[model samples]
Target: MNFKGKSLSLKEYNDLADILQNKYGMQFLGDYEALCSNIAAGKEEEKNQAKPEPVIKQGQGDEEKAVFIRGTIRSGQLIRSEGNIVVLGDVNPGAYLEAAGSITVMGKMRGTGHAGTQGDYSTYIAAFRLEPMQLRIGDIVTRPPDGKQYKSKVPEMAFVKKGMIIVEPYLGKR
Candidate 1:
């Protein structure tokens, strides 16, 4: 499954195809079994896929960076960015990441990450896992608990709660 540097699969790209094809239908295509019947199935196939675009134009003033990185950050790699950052692949141990805003991992991160590096408490960091060697936000830092319960779990998010960082479950957008 090393699809790194590759385009998204048709299946992965089409998960929300039906939703995109409908704007104001009485019944959404994915709402219920019966509701799906009324929606035009062909619409999904007819809709054109929108490719990604850069957040900032090349000639834009001030040159704001909303996101940085598009590949695996292996062990020992270090990334210091002023805006949000994304790792399209795994982040191996010994890697260091610092972002002023949120950080998203379309893959796994097993290194050290510090979102809110600019003291932005609103920062959020998410990966295919929350099992990093260390996680931090602003001036607060916490290492993954060295126990069985954490080592076996899946991907999650880390956010501040009660003036402390608390790792919690993340179900994508929800």
Candidate 2:
């Protein structure tokens, strides 16, 4: 916090890292694995006793890579990640998910999934259950059948074909 001042004490730096780790699942700073190893390898005490260098590096590349999400996309849940999004559990109806790349939901999907919100035409939506009220990719839009959970099967992926969205099973080729 007080980077302008003299070098930061180890306690101060470590406290800051701890705060960031607790506040956010993972700090935007460099990987914590090395730090953990340093502490576990008994070098932490030595490093802490001395003035610790500034952690200059931040998160690595692949910033646009798909984010592997592992949870149920519950109602009122809004998941917006930079790259592709993958959900391990079901996505409730009222929830919303918008990603730059493709979206794959392992569990039931009944929410709104907007792929290519950043304007990529090749983006897609894949879900264990595709029964969304609406879906959009690039400049195309599509709505599922009227009945509740009609022809939509257990595993389906929706993509634009001939300026229209076509939902297909994800089990085999094509």
Residue-wise lDDT of candidate 1 within 6-58, one digit each (tens)?
23344643544454556534343333333334334434534643543433222
**Ten contiguous residues minimizing lDDT sum, candidate 1:** 54-63
Instruction: Tell me the lDDT of model 2 at 126.
Output: 91
lDDT minimum window of 10 residues, candidate 2: 54-63
lDDT leader: 2
Per-prediction CA RMSD (Å): 12.3, 13.0
TM-score of each candidate? 0.59, 0.59
Clash totals for all models, in order?
0, 0
Candidate 1 off by > 4 Å: 1-64, 172-174
RMSD of 2: 13.0
Per-residue lDDT of model 2, residues 101-156, tens digit only = 77888888788888877667677899887878688886677778775666455588
**Residue pairs with clashing backbones, model 1:** none
